[model samples]
Target: MIWQGRSRRKPTGGLYRPHRKKRKYEMGRPQTETLIGERKIKLERVRGGNYKVKLVRDKYANVYVPSEGKVVRVEIKRVVENPAHVHYARRNVITKGAIIETEIGLARVTNRPSQEGLINAVLIEQK
Candidate 1:
């Protein structure tokens, strides 16, 4: 498992001795690469008594249109551009700041779908 704790190195490039062993709470999981497909989600129990809804795959998005002043549910056609990674666009991995092709038009993802379990985007250019 990946560790989410602080690094062992200091800002001055000095190595620091271990103060204590790693705890389970400090562990991390793999990244959720959300893709366009049939809806799929995972429920994860996080710290505190809460749960995290991880989105694995989805095909629709709630696109907000400024001209209409309302949100509309639209089908995602494909990934256009992903600022997070160059290959993400080709792989169709959805992430925040990614431009996607939807039934309404081109839209920019405004939220982290993998973390929010939903895709929210703002209409950019109309079809």
Candidate 2:
């Protein structure tokens, strides 16, 4: 389990004794790594009785073409660039701001696939 609580050490390099135990409200969850593959989705529960849609794996993306002013669904050919991590592109991990190759052309992902359930990208190059 991840703790989102206060630090154990002070800024002056002094140890801070815990006054109380951990609480459920100060908790964190693991990260979801969305990958390129067959369509797969997972629903997760969040704080305040809410639900979040997570895209576990996917092969297609909704690409918005500025020239046409419309969105099109196209097959994701591969991950080209990922600013989050260099290895993410090589492993085909889809993330926001990632440049991906699509059937229509190259696109830059605009939405968070892990949190949005679907990939949305803006067209950067036309084929």
Candidate 3:
């Protein structure tokens, strides 16, 4: 688990003792890598007594084309670019703000595919 709290050191270089142990509220989960493949989802129990569906693998995306002024469900052809990381672009890991090539055209992802279980993209320039 990742630590979600601040360090015990002060900005002036003074050490501060812990007042309490690490709580579950200060824990974080690892990042999910949404890959290109058949749809796969994982149910995760989040805080506040709720559940979140994480997409492990997804093959489709809902692409919104401004030229047509409509949203279309299209199959993702491949990852075009990922400004988040060069490795992600090479490995075809779909994250938010990634540019993906769909059946309709090139689109920029607007949502976190791994956490949202669905890919939403807005059409950019055509290839």
lDDT of 1 by residue, 1-127 (tens): 4556678899999998988987888777788999999999999888997998999999999999998799999999999999999999999999999999999889999999999999999999544
Output the better candidate (1/2) by lDDT.
Answer: 1
TM-score of each: 0.89, 0.88, 0.91
lDDT of 2 by residue, 11-99 (tens): 99999999998788777677789999899999998889899999999999999999889999999989999999889999999989999
Give stretches of model 3 more than 4 Å off. 1-3
Candidate 3 lDDT over 1-127, as tens digits, reads 4556778799999998989997888777888999999999999999998988899998999998887799999999899899988899889999999999888778999998778789999999645
Number of the top candidate by lDDT? 1
Better TM-score candidate (1, 3): 3
Which residue window of length 10 is worst by lDDT in model 2? 1-10
- Measure candidate 2: CA RMSD: 2.5
- Give the whole-model CA lDDT for all candidates, comma-separated: 0.94, 0.92, 0.90
Error of 1 at 59 (Å): 0.5
Question: Which candidate achieves the best TM-score against the true structure?
Answer: 3
